[model samples]
Target: MYQLKTKETENSVIEFIENVEQPKKREDAYRLLDIFSETTGYPAKMWGPSIIGFGSYHYKYATGHEGDAPLVGFSPRKAKISLYFATGDTAREALLEQLGKHTAGKGCVYINKVADINEDILKELIQQSVQFLKETYPAEE
Candidate 1:
């Protein structure tokens, strides 16, 4: 059994952001917190030590691996801010194309600062990700 390291925790998202070494990154985190919250219509929660996540869905893979994950999240890292969104959403690729300046990984989009990208596109990405996850893994009552 593999345990996910990034499981949601009770840590303070505000404290985490306030502790960011860069004042600008700290400010960007606050901006992202608002964006993700308003876009997803869900309040933020801490995932692991760094991630500020909004909304969540449980997923079980074909291989029997399963876990709950945030619908969308972001981490203000040292080098660049990493944005977390749904990986399998086809719309994500298209949105990434429209997103201004950023680099992406398996499931994280890296941006130097909030000013480096378009907030509207980021909001669209967040909305699409939440919709995709809700459809893919509808929440249980």
Candidate 2:
């Protein structure tokens, strides 16, 4: 059984951002906190030690692996800020094309700063991620 390293914690998101070493990264973190919160319509939560996440959905894979993950999240790493969005969403690729300056990884998008990308497109990615996850892994009511 594989355990996920990044699980949601009770840590304060603001506190985490304040502790970020780089002044620019710290400032960007705060800006991202607001953007993610307003865009997702859900409050921010600390995921693992660094990721600031909003909204969550449980997923079970065909191989029987199951876990809960945030619908969208970001981490202000020293090298680059990582944006976490739904990998299954086809629209993500199209949005990223218009997302300005950013690098896409296997599961995360890396940006130097928020200004390097379009906030409106970022919000769309967040919205589409949440919608795709909810639809793909519909929560049990």
Candidate 3:
């Protein structure tokens, strides 16, 4: 399971954001924090070294692979902001097309900056991803 040592990581995330020399990037991180909180209705917390996460869920597969993960999260990376949607292959081509300028990896969306994307579309993407994850994994007690 991916257990988060929240106390240690939370301060790290805050400091990391605070030290971002680019004023625009720093502001974007704060904006993303608010967007994530509003979308998840859960307070933001750091997950591991860099990710700002919200909520959590447990998953167990038939193959005995099981773990707990943040419901949704993002990390501010040097080249781009990595948005963790946890819906790697769920056919979101339509959303991606409308998401403005961004690239994606197997399980994450990489945006150079919030200014480079449509905020409304990004919010919809986040909301849809959260809904998809909830339905796919459903939380386990």
Candidate 4:
């Protein structure tokens, strides 16, 4: 069976953010922590070694590959800040256009800093991602 590398851990999110090498990235991480926490109404959690994630959801693919992942998250990397959002949301593209400055991958949006992007747009992305995931993959109760 294949295993997922990124799993929720009991690590300290504050300690992780404080240890961020760059001063700017560290500050941005804190800001993101506040934004994501307030927006998602979920506490910040250490997902794997680096990602600071909000709410979580479980996803199963047609290939039988499934795992629980954060509905929204971000990582302040050395080069750029990576924002994690739902990959299947079509509305993301439209919002990204209005988002000040950023580069996006399949599931991650890279930004130079928090100031470089629109905070409102970021919040919308977070909310949309969370809603999309919840609707797409409801909790198995």
Candidate 5:
């Protein structure tokens, strides 16, 4: 199993957010932090170098790949924010249609600005993603 190196907690995440230079980006990050915290009921934490994550789960695939990862997370990128959701089979086509203006890539949904999307729909997406992860991984602890 791949072990997580960084401590997953609020202080570390807050410090990282504080260091963000751009005011708009920082504010967006803070909003995302609040949304993820409220939706997942897990305090925000720094994952690796840039990702802000919530909760965690351990996974072991039949192919022998194993690791522990955050149940949900997002990274504030230069061009857009990348929201992570591990929904391999669960289709979110309906939700995406209602998600407003945005793009997607692999396991990430990208948004240029939160203002361009519906806040309520965003929260619903987070909640649905959390539910999917819980059912797929079924937390060991």
Candidate 6:
């Protein structure tokens, strides 16, 4: 019975941003909060102690592990910011190609700062990720 640790919390997103060690990262956190909220049509919520997530969806794996996760989220880490998105989205690779200076992991896009990436491309990635999750999981009404 493995439990997901990143469930949404009622903690303040504003306070989280304000506590960021770097001033620039704090500013970028606010900027991203606006971007993700506007794009996902959902208000920001704290995921665990760090991640600022917008929307959420429940996913059940083939192994029967199930958990709810954010549709799109970002964390301002000490080294770089981590952008979380759906894994195996068919359009993701193409969008990442157009995205400027960012490094990719299985499901996280790491960026040095807000200025290092193109805003339009980031929005597209957010939209695509949200769409893919909605289509794949189809949240219960």
Q: Would you list the clashing residue pairs of candidate 4?
A: none
Greater TM-score among 5 and 6 belongs to: 6
Error of 5 at 106 (Å): 0.9
In the range 58-130, model 5's lDDT, one tens digit per residue, is 7789998777788888888888888887767455667778988899877789988778888788888788777
Better of 3 and 5 by lDDT: 5
| Candidate 2: regions farther than 4 A off | none
Give per-model CA RMSD.
Answer: 0.9, 0.8, 2.9, 0.7, 2.4, 0.8
lDDT of 3 by residue, 1-141 (tens): 654353224456568789777788888999998888887898887777788888777778898867677877888887788988866545566888888999988888899898888888878877887777788888666
Cα lDDT tens digits, model 4, 65-98, are 9999999999888899999999877888888899
Q: Considering TM-score, where higher is better, how would the candidates rank from best to worst?
A: 4, 2, 6, 1, 5, 3
The whole-model lDDT of each prediction reads 0.93, 0.93, 0.79, 0.92, 0.80, 0.93
- For residue 25, model 5's alpha carbon misses the true position, in angstroms, by 1.1
- Least accurate stretch of 10 residues (summed lDDT) in model 4? 87-96
How do the predictions measure up, each by TM-score? Answer: 0.97, 0.97, 0.85, 0.98, 0.87, 0.97
Candidate 1, residues 12-66: lDDT per residue as tens digits? 9898999999999999999999999888889899999889999889999999999
> What is residue 68's positional error in candidate 3, in angstroms?
1.2
Which one wins by lDDT: 3 or 4? Answer: 4
Q: For candidate 2, what is the TM-score?
A: 0.97
User: lDDT per residue, candidate 6, 52-76, as tens digits?
Assistant: 9988899988999999999999999
TM-score of the candidate numbered 5?
Answer: 0.87
Instruction: At residue 116, give the lDDT of candidate 1.
Output: 87
Q: How close is candidate 4 to the true structure, as a TM-score?
A: 0.98
